[model samples]
Target: MDGQPTADVVDQVKDIPIYRTSVERGHFPILEKPEIADGFPDNWMTPRLAAALAAGEAEFVLSTGTNHARMQIIRPPYFLLNSYYKLWSEHPDISATWEAGCQRVSLTTVLATEHVARVNAKKRGGEPEAVPPLDDRRLDARTLYLNLRLDPALWERDDVVRMLAEIRTAQQAHPRGWYHLDCSGYHLAHLVQKARAWGLWEDFPQPASIIHAYEYTPLNVRRHLREHFTCPVVDLFGSTELGYLYYSDRHGHYRPYLDEMSVELVPVAPGSRIHSLIVSSVRNPYMPLIRYRSGDCARTLDGSPDPEKISRFCGREKELLATPHGPVAQADLDDRIADASPRVFLHQLHVTAGEAVLHHTTFDGEPLDPRACAVLERELRGLTGLRSRIEHREHIPVGKSGKYAWLVQDR
Candidate 1:
């Protein structure tokens, strides 16, 4: 659209750019000697990108990388605005729920743990046992893990019972559903289980389809909802790079936002065609990324990048747990335990850390017989490589950033 031809713009960035910008965005990571731009970091910003920036189009920046290796990605303002619109303003179901005056009762840990730390029990099962004593737990909202690990009996504790009563009072004051409960599938399951334990299963007002993102919405969670509530349980799929790319239909099956995203598949090994995702989105014009790796495995009916036909968007490749044979994806663990109970959604399995803890939460907060929890613990040990003493924790806070961390490493 500017002075340069499209071909010239495309050719200038024919190769990958070396990234040096701040991991958080805009803070440049490296200042090159300029004598040799060739040796710059990989995934660098190109001249074409600079031109687009000069033209006053790109606005929002998205980050891509592991916890340590983050990269800044800019996009046209319209892309994000539209994305938000489609999610809330345009979606009648969501908008209607919001307009009802629901306040965000986030189960997410925005800050680190705080004053109530000592109360946190030691993790007993899985490899690498860890006990984050109250002093170790962060106080800020960001660090508190959401109560994703639900033990049905947790509600029996006076504090939890009080919280439920408080929530119910707030709901009554608002009348039309006053609170919005946001969490992952696992988190919601814990909530449901907690509610059941209080003899409040039919009593507690259900949230507008508990927004379960940050992980695959295990099928059992959906079944749990359909069986328990009259409300729709939404499952959304996206990454930090792509934002929210796919969401469940009213029926709760994912429908791709193909109009906004372009998807590609890159082989995992050299020859084996089983590939993960590489996204090149026109969503953000400020920083138009070409063939951006999403680190997620996927499969489409036909050999195509068409987002609509993508049959599956499995767990992150990097997050896959190592097993004796090879690697085991999160879905594999989910499948093995799927039959354990639809009531169970939130789960964390740490191997050999403390004892070996398989902290789990179901929709109805009924405590599993210690024996059942033990069975799950043993199964998880065999699945992952770790011997552990099994026990249940009432609390497993989600990261305040609004994503759930499945695997926690202690030490």
Candidate 2:
């Protein structure tokens, strides 16, 4: 989401009085959007599109390049009302995230470290700090850093100081207000490192919750916040078509924001713990779906999921690591990594040569303590049903579709 302006998004909501009556009468579509009555695809943007169209905007589109490839949802007004039902159903607090001077912020680069790109380019105590150029926003609010000349070998000094300055500026602009930090995990991890190097750790602003929604948060980075910060460091799961379906608490555990969603689980294969996440979300009435397969995988941690204790939100179903023994889910491995560090930010588990390589991103700005890494390896080896290699990656690659891939296979 990038620079989404506030229009009368509420007018997009379908009639609620009749739907609420239905819900009270033990019929769910009671409060559902109108498009729901007509039916639409699971991932369609019918309701949201409806709102955008009413405002007369054609740029309404869904996110591409994440796990499910990319899907474009065209929303008209009928579809717009559906979004209200879905967003406010279970998670009423979400309105706050949007209410706090919120707008969508996105980038073309899979791994963007706008926060610390210049600092990583410097030599200790050498030059006057410099900052990279501010993004040029098209009057339409779209931005592109794709051609920003960021040569790794030639990071100058002036921009390093400038980057730090920018981060401070944004955080202070709303010291007590809420803001979404929607950057890559790598970008966040690098920024943390730069903060330590510049002795600016003390100056870092404290937001209500640090949201690592756009990319995966490594276990080590998660621990740092739990060990240090007073506020919550949370993450969420959803696609562009649907705004958000789930969010985690302060301790990195997922809870469903069902809205008007009826979720189902189907096995990826026989006798496999991994199940496909089928969602019938009614957020965009203009695009109501029935039994829609979202192409993501999740397993109930208990016999019946508690909803509140959804320990993990594994990435794309197609990316599950299948082997002779069974399939290894990403969330399971991440839990093990978090067990190793109190503060982690991003992670990549590579299956190579019959062993799992755990590459982590950290807010601590360094590889996990060697002893902790060794201990983590032992736990991961047992979890993955294979040997383990726990290490760090300077930058883990986000999927071609712009989602993080927890598991990768290389012969």
Question: Which digits, one per residue and each the tens of the lDDT, describe model 2 over residues 1-411?
Answer: 111112222233233332334334433321222333233333234455546567765334444445544455554432322443234233433445545543323222322433223323332333323434453221112112221223311223443455445544554555354443444444454545565666766755544434555545556655554454565556667765555777766555677877666566666788876767666655654544444566677766762434344555666666777666677666667777677776456677777777888787655547777888888889877876778888786666545444456777886
The segments of candidate 1 whose C-alpha lies over 4 angstroms from its true place after superposition are: 1-70, 76-81, 87-183, 186-210, 225-228, 267-274, 299-309, 343-345, 352-403, 408-411
Candidate 2 local lDDT, residue 84: 31
**How much is the lDDT of residue 50 in candidate 1?**
61
TM-score of 1: 0.58
Single out the weakest 10-residue window by summed lDDT for candidate 2.
Answer: 138-147
lDDT of 1 at 48: 61
Model 1 Cα lDDT, one tens digit per residue, 1-411: 111213433443344343222222432221222311244222445666566668856543434332223445456644532553356434434666656655433343222122124323223232221433322443222122333223322335454554455456545655665555555554455556666765666666666634555566666766775677666556666654466776666575557664445566665555432456766554554444444566676656674544567666657666666556455556656665676555565666665443446676644446666656666667777767666544455566554443455556562
Model 1 lDDT-worst window of ten: 28-37
RMSD of each: 10.9, 10.5
